[model samples]
Target: MPYKRIKWLILWTPTVTIALWEYIRHTFLLPYLSMDLGNALAPVIVLTVTVTLVYKLFHLLEQTSDSLQRERLAKAAFVEREQLARELHDGISQSLFLLSVKLDKLEHTQDKESVQATAQQIRKTVKHVYDDVRQSIASLRSEPSMTEVQWMQSVEEMAVELRLGGLQVELDWRLTDSDLTSKEKIELLAIVREAMLNVQKHARAKRLIVNAFKAENISAGGFNCTIMDDGIGVDDPALEAKGRYGVRMMRDRANAMGWQFEVGRNDSKDNNQTVGTVVAVTKGG
Candidate 1:
């Protein structure tokens, strides 16, 4: 029962019980017991009933709340599993397809130079697939502690993986290990990973620069992360369409955390050509 109802019940139960006892004392229980005795016992009976009923009702409410919470967590876990499955399928399937093509080429070509190049490409692709699987497994198996140094290390590892895809990555870290919440850290890690994956899958960039650190001049008392890629620069309509999902997901993560996200082509000072793509996010205080 709700608190209001319980409060009202406790407030009115004594009066109602006394009224009933007065009406029934002369007719109902007087034949078996004295009127004064009946009056004394009626209040005790009412008190017992009130206490027992309130205790049982509150216990039920507590149980129900616990059950609802468990259900919610279960649902969230299911959704996360489904999303991971989709990501692995998309990423691993592409790598496997490329690997198969290279193998086929190696089998058909008799030229030593062509075979050597194909074998090298296969090794690189295999390493990338291995890294992806390892990261995915880690994400599934455990939630890492939200420590600043560890989070940065994970970003560095991701940068290493991007290097496997031939993207040169530069990391600029300046943030102090303070004031970041666990939720913020998790969301930031996810956003960074997704952004890097997008770069590897579609950016076709030769160089990527990731700057993540605290800024003293920022109004929102939070850190900043900018990922710049010197690639074809998100100009191709087909590539844009393919990358839209990742961009949307990153934006959603930032918005959900009350952060700011911006993505666009980095135009040169001459304004004559697209230089690269920049994905920038700023977390709010």
Candidate 2:
């Protein structure tokens, strides 16, 4: 029961009991010393007890409410910190990648030109940025994305929870033979992971189908992951927009990769109302 209801019981039970006792004593002990003293003393004692009991009950309720609120606030703070750390790792590290690429192009030349010397300076600067980004990433969050095997492992682990919950999920993936950087892997994993969570939550999905492929989109290349589920569809037009930081996090990861991010409903041939959400990451447009 809620604290308010408990308080109501506490207040009313005592008041009723005291009133019944006074009525009985007055009716039965009428001939005894029914003096001004008894009349004055009985009311004073009853009021004192009522005040004391009500105060204590209120104090208990106040303490419990404060403790629960403190716990909720602490949890919110922790989640906020984790989100900030993830953003710094995924966002700040991109500069290091660009710097490293430029430095590499400048490094390999038999020609002892000013460009070569400038390349050395650029290499040194890139190294500094790389070290800082790595340190911050270590302090933040990640899942390796460098190889196909690691990417698959990350996806499987992410879905292990659903398996534990007894949901039937089928995950299939295809990767480009080309290797990806660690930062790219994290971006891909975070984006895919967020989409998976949405499927588990709003979809009420008993069965899920995930297909990932690597392909070129125009001049840009990207990894595409399509998730289909036999679950209830959402009606909100702004579900993708006004929803919490989940969509924001997905978009942020996609932005860092210069990838196009698309997600929403599509056709279900079985008529069991299976809907799909596709997240295509292409070179940033």
Candidate 3:
């Protein structure tokens, strides 16, 4: 039976049974039994029925709740594993593939300068793959519940990291902790960190701005997070060659959470000139 129905039965069954017993005792049983005797028996009968019925109903309700909780935990674990697999495929696996290709090129190369360049590329690819592995391990070990202050601190840390690379960074965060769940905060922080890394490595911009706020234009309960850089814009071939994997991972993460992800060139309003690149992740609309 459904949970609500079981609760209703538990609540009303005893009362209804007592009322019916009283009506029968007064109307028919009184002819055969004394009024005092009937009244004395009523308490014992009601107590026995209520205890038995309530015990059985309570057991059923507890079982139903436990089953639902187990199902939810199982589903959440499955989704987490799937996302981890995708991250490995997009980040480390692709980097390893590129590393193999570079090794093959190194074998055939005869010139000294070319060999040095290929070896350098191999080392860079290996370092990137190593970083990805470490990041995955850290994520697996991270606490599941993150406070609002911790979330903000994580974002600030990313900004501080970028500053060390000689890029000017500004933050304009408006969304409160209530705006997103624990899982949502983790995924959003990952996306933002990826965007900042892209800017650090490939944007070649003098300034970068990060913004997070509720966006009415998107939809009800919608949020917008944008990372803007005054860099070479979306037309840069270097970003396409080196930063494509990170971008793909970001998009995949956002899509997995049913959010919108977009990357485009930031353009001037008065003129048609491209100013920089904008990476946005939005929820709802």
- lDDT scores in order: 0.71, 0.63, 0.79
Off by over 4 Å in 1: 1-70, 76-121, 124-141, 145-190, 203-208, 219-221, 229-245, 252-258, 264-276
Quick one: ranking by TM-score, best first? 1, 3, 2
Give candidate 3 misplaced runs (Cα > 4 Å).
Answer: 97-110, 141-285
Give the top-scoring candidate (lDDT). 3
Ranking of all candidate structures by their lDDT, best first: 3, 1, 2
Pairs with steric clashes in candidate 3: none
lDDT per residue (tens digit) for residues 1-285 in model 3: 887888898898889878988999988888998979988888988888877987888899899888878999999998788667755864576567556656777898899998998788788779988987887777753544675226777568657646744688989999888988888888898788778767866678888889999987877778999998888888545445753778877887899899999887878531333458999899987
Model 1: lDDT equals 0.71
Q: Report the CA-based lDDT of candidate 2 relative to the real structure.
A: 0.63
Of 1 and 3, the candidate ranking higher by TM-score: 1
Query: Distance (Å) between predicted and true CA of 153, model 2?
Result: 1.7
lDDT of 2 at 144: 38
Candidate with the larger TM-score of 1 and 2: 1
Could you give candidate 2's per-residue lDDT for residues 22-126 as a string of tens digits? 777688765774667567767776777667876676777788788879989999889768666565534344334335544554565456775766576566656
The backbone clash count of each candidate, in order, is 0, 4, 0
Lowest-lDDT window of 10 residues in candidate 3? 266-275
Clashing pairs in 2: 145-185, 258-283, 258-284, 260-282
